[model samples]
Target chain A: MDDARLAELYERYGFLVHRRCLQLVRRPEDAEDALQETFLRVKRYGPPRDGGATLAWLYTVAARCCFDLMEKRGREPVAEESQLAALEERGDGSTEDADRRALLGAALRTLDGKTRTIGVLHYLDGYTQDEVAAQTGFSRKTVGKKLKTFEDRIRQLFAGRSHEARR
Target chain B: MTAPLPPSPRGPECPPAAVLEALSAGEPTPDATRAHVQACAACGAQLEALTTGRDAFLRARPADRFLRQLERREAAAPSPWRRLFPVLAAVVPVLVLVLVLGPRLTGDGPGVTWKGEAFRVVVSRAGAEAVPLAQDSAVKEGDRLRFAYESPEAGHLLVLELDGRGGATVFHPFEGTASAPLAAGQRDFLPGSVELDDAPGTEWLFAVFSPRPLQAAPLLARLREQAGRAEPTLTCDGCRVSSLRLRKAP
Candidate 1:
């Protein structure tokens, strides 16, 4: 996309990209940083396609940017860990919902960069399987396979964590 | 003399992804595909995966307020003129002035104003009336407590009850999901009353408000060990912590 087009894309999908970033990083400033970084990368390297494909492509880029930021922060995202620990201390392990989120976050960390991006786009960002496949250059079959694999792994992780909490 | 058919798109097997998608969307899977999934371990696993992923999706929410904050950041991003064109040097002083004076004028410095009054942890018992807690209010073990709050804007709320001796427990998000949503300008309470456990002393209660959900486990563990020495009030990015003190009845 050209400069005018990039500007237009930014205006049209700014919130979309930002939303994905926030879901991953959970910090407003970090989310903003990820948003700026994603667009900057887009501006530097042209988008994968035009029209509706662009949104999927953008979602993929935003997911990667957010994960990259998470990776750069090391093991767990600092803000999320800090906040999660704060909340967890206030109770025993009976908070099943919070544990599930913690479990999901931990499970996500186990995925490779590409798989994590795909999962975030499809699951958290609510992209359709076709859209994820289109953005990631995977066949719909492969996307389906990967998503299934992700689910199994996350469930296992959640189970282990819950078991540990019970112990 | 019949036209040859193009290759079959369905082939001998159904596309596992399409079937999983349909299943996740709550649509009926093709009968043949469902039968195939039941018999094929790989397809069955895929279906299970889709189920787990959809569950996560149901729990997840877009960080709307934070996304808007990012848009604001984009709008306020440094203009190209400031970076590319030296000819606009005259605008530099004004930019500098705004940066230097804005925080001071707006009270946007490090301090975060805690809105303790916005939330109340009312305590009562089976035969008694409920009253908003005041600092040092005496309460015995088994006193039932419920939280009531008014949020200035839609946000996530986390309540932590800190035993003055250094233990903390979460109270607001009673269900224990990532965070609980509180609508702006409305008084809300936990769906049920929480009975005070055996931990008895001058306990500190903290109510944390954030514009979006937060994963706060790490901080909770840290505070559990250090809460006794920590100050009653604390602040973090996008979150404001408010406090109340209560004493266990002697």
Candidate 2:
């Protein structure tokens, strides 16, 4: 597509771009950055006329940007044993931010390192699970199992967090 | 053609998040998802939760306003796109923000006053003319001095700016109200308001907008052309204006 047509597509897809990024990036401004970067790529390499793969392709670019942005911030949200330990020591927000973070953290910590990475890069990043599997080199079956597990853990974690926050 | 959002499904007896997502995507939903959303409590809560988020995020966002400005910008912007025109694209949105946020945020150009000997000129878009309401005119007890207009589309201003100085020079960029129509061949009596500190001769200008050291412009050309030099005046004899010997370039 031409730049104008690409821009039209970009605008139409902005909300999804933003929401998907928000779950992983933890900040609205960062999500906006990811979105801009996504469009900048689309601008550089004209997107497909197929349109079906357009969102998937955009998601891949955004996924990479998220990793880069995370790396830039030196907050690679990996599930190393040490990292999981650090998560347990969590900060003092104790409010919704802390509570949400803790639930997300516990759920994230439970996944195998690769699985967790895929889950965050997909659901949290707004990538389809298939795209996540493709980017991370996981089988689609593995990615699906990881996401379902991730979801269950998160539900329990958030439920627990909500209970704690309530008290 | 884009299809309407599917009827909502239920989970948790509330609307579903998926429904909003589908709607946001401007896509059609499957019958199962729609039925599930309408009856499912969990899905219903998800919908409410997501809708609330959408409302908060999109609501807090000046998106609607920005979208309108972008529309106007696209309309007015020239085809040869350049990265350097960020400032130009921003003009409409900035104008919309100021108006939506109220006058204090806008700094100046809300109300400007010029005292003509025969009448007082207050330049604000209140009446029809797409022109400033003239202070000196056949004022009647109910005659309003001016009116404002906001172009329906965003790019009008860009095109306005490019359409050349005359038309572009006379815009109340933020004024988005309806325009008052002047009669057929009815000469425009008063152009709008005059600035006290403009250089000694009149310079035809569009409404000048700025925050610091706000000033007004003479509506002479606009006035003369509006009504064919029909000495714009006050409707009442008892009324008084600040000054009448307005500095004329002529």
Docking class of 2: incorrect
For each candidate, report its DockQ versus the true two-chain complex. 0.02, 0.03
Tell me the TM-score of each prediction against the true structure. 0.33, 0.34
Q: Candidate 2: lDDT over CA atoms? A: 0.43
lDDT of 2 by residue, B1-250 (tens): 2121111222243323323455445556677767776676555555565456555655555444434544554566466556547866888788776545543343223343223222223333345443233422222222223322222222111000101112213322222221123222222333343222223332222322112222112332333333322233211111111223222222
Off by over 4 Å in 1: A1-167, B1-113, B175-177
lDDT, candidate 1, B58-102, per-residue tens: 344223443354456557878886676675577777887765554
- Locate the minimum summed-lDDT window of 10 residues in model 1 chain A: A87-96
Task: Summarize candidate 2's per-residue lDDT along A1-167 as a digit string, tens digits.
Answer: 46567546655555556565544454556666666666656656777446354544565567566656776766423332332233211111223333344335335545676766765554343355566677778899988887767767766665665576599
Best by TM-score: 2
Off by over 4 Å in 2: A1-7, A48-57, A76-167, B1-20, B41-45, B48-250
Give me the displacement of residue A14 in model 1, in angstroms.
62
Q: Please list, in the order the candidates appear, how each scores on TM-score for chain B only.
A: 0.53, 0.20
